[model samples]
Target: MAILFRRVALVQLAPRLGDVEYNLNLIEHGVQRARAQSAELVVFPELAVTGYFLKDMVSTVALRIDGPEVARLASLSRGLELIVGAVEESEDYRFFNSALYFRDGELTYIHRKVYLPTYGLFDEARYLARGDRIRCFSSALGRTAILICEDLWHPSTAYIAALDGAVALVCPSSSPLRGISEGKDHDDNAAYWELLNAVYAQTFGVFVVYVNRVGFEDGVGFWGGSEIVSPVGNRLAKAKYYEEDFVVADLSLKEPRRQRVQAPLLRDENLDLTIRELQRIQRCRGTLGHQECGESHADCEGETDAGLEER
Candidate 1:
């Protein structure tokens, strides 16, 4: 069989605050540049259309899934698949941090951010609703999954996507630079992202692509160390930090299969056993009528012990 190859682009651009038209025009220009280089898939940073740090402006600048702006993006993505981040407004006017996938002049899939950080410099939970589902979907570049910013920090999110047969994991982030790591080329935030990307790629035996924006907003600076990691956890391409850049790299579809066969982590995973163990853990919460059950108090205690032992 012939091996399939795809050229993917990671666009790290600074978005104007609350300026949807300007950001959209920038994105269109980036897409045109990527298309000129014959890129099959182009990915952008989180909230690339509306910009991050939009405390109250999120609701105001949120785009409907079927809004005219989306149509314009769909039209721009005529032949190539484009993954860009934007604030999505629901029918009831609720807003969500979302990533939209456009291909063949049509919106293919939408991944709403599941984990919204509200600690420290982040306050996403206050502005956007959380997404409930995480699953892999078919894309032009084979089975793929999208995780917005903080979603990638939770290991279960990537694990679920990997179990669902995702060959590539794409993450769009707008992470800010915080602290300085000694002897490292990037900041602490960038270093942590590199570690996370490598771990996920190696553990799941899947390609990992991360795109982060660069620029200062409200005195906070976003770090732009966007990168592409291979299935074996090798850094294939990386963009410069604290600057806007457009980087592209070609990936082989066979790499995931090759790495999976070498590691076999997915083949050894036990979903049913995991589910049963989780159920046991939940049952150990000790509700009102627990001791009245036929299993007796001793068995209930044993369930908790057994759950711990399984872990």
Candidate 2:
């Protein structure tokens, strides 16, 4: 494979909901700023176009994949590859949480968020349709895959993207604030960091760039730990918590190549096969009654044999 561009910048913008004009201008400004720094690619936070708290209004403001808003951004992105978020309308008239990639004065690719988060403050299931596929958008940089906030929390999507020829993973999120009102014991911010590290280091060994939103919205303040993680899972650079700024990092494509050669996690036993086998084993073990399950391996083996015979 050929080596691509080595420098990129992430724009962590603090955007408000239902503000289209302002967000468009802000994205254009961010692209220019990244170009000034000689960065090849510029990534913005998730849902930066309309803000994340628009709730039901997302459908009304959702732009067609070929609409004017993206066209304007594409024209403005002359020298930099820009990845920004907006609501996208599918051909079937369904709306999706989407990201548009603009490069070389045109729209390159669009990724609809695959994982629709329903827990806590998120109700994406109510507004946007979930994408059932994984894909990598071809860019001048390299084979790149895009994931929205919640998808990064799990390894399934990342591994699938890697298998599909993604050498770099870009995750854009509107991460909400936690721990302040819930008190000190609620500081589970490390979960985000830990998940990022593991995804970068263990599964694909590819470059992981995460861009997160900052500032408060509807009583939730986002934790801004926007960062660039290396193939070995080391955090190369990161933004401060609850602030707005840009972080630029120079990554040699040679790094991931070197790391993969040393530890080829991608070529390990097929995960699909492992998952199927595990499911089969679980089926054999059968369900246990409330208080009947214990440390007895004999009972478990007997149940497994019985279930297998019945099958």
Candidate 3:
């Protein structure tokens, strides 16, 4: 009873800022539309519930995992699998920008954004707490990992997912369109994002289902361009840029199996070697204790990894 093929929907939506009720309606409609088309799964962009750039209004729209908002979201998963993002309020009252994966009408996995960018026009670290781990979980579509927003910018997140035997990397992001040129049709950041998606797909031999939002929030536009990249670095499906669009891609598990057999990069990844190198690096930086890496910096000065140097 292995699932080899299924149709997946990408909801490149634009949520009304701080309006959770309106966003819920949009999600319900999106689910109905996708389910009618016989899609096995549907994905939304990061912060889909509350919208991005909710500077001070973040808490006002935050939803607990067991709250009615999530219950309503889970209710959408009677037959179809779904992935959505929201501001999660923890029991300790800390909020996190998180992606929730639901299967069989139950909350299965929640991935919080780890690397919060606090630069010009981006201030996630100011309000949200960071996630500590990257894990691969099972679903009807097989093994998958959810990395929210800036988590995709860090290669280690994807690397860990791949190493943990993830067949698909599901990234929900709210990246704004930047570096607009007069003659160009797409933003500079959009092209770079496509490149990143392709690189991750081909390198890890895993399907990359990248769902990004569209429209404006606080005067900053988000170029949708949501795309699904195949294991061998091919664009399987792409949505319209700067507009709301729903696109479905029929994906087969056989492709990732074939890509791994053909390229075998994931097969060649040396986890033990990587761990040793990381321990050594940490020891050199005085972060690791003597038991794991070494007693002092001088003891590990000669130890180096080419991967570390290259990065």
Per-residue lDDT of model 1, residues 146-215, tens digit only: 9998999999999999999998999999999998867977789888899999999999998999999999
- TM-score each candidate: 0.92, 0.84, 0.91
lDDT of 1: 0.92
Which residue pairs show collisions in model 3? none
**lDDT of every model, 2 decimals:** 0.92, 0.79, 0.89
Candidate 2 residue lDDT tens string, 200-234: 65468788888888878788787777888888777
lDDT string, candidate 3, 151-251, tens digits: 99999999999989998999998989999767877999998999999999999999999999998976899999999999988898999989999999989
Worst 10 residues of 3 by lDDT: 287-296
Off by over 4 Å in 1: 285-311
Clashing pairs in 2: 177-221
lDDT of residue 174 for candidate 3: 93
> Model 1 has how many clashing residue pairs?
0
Clashes of each: 0, 1, 0
Give the 10-residue window scoring lowest on summed lDDT in candidate 2. Answer: 290-299
Measured by TM-score, how close is model 1 to the native structure?
0.92
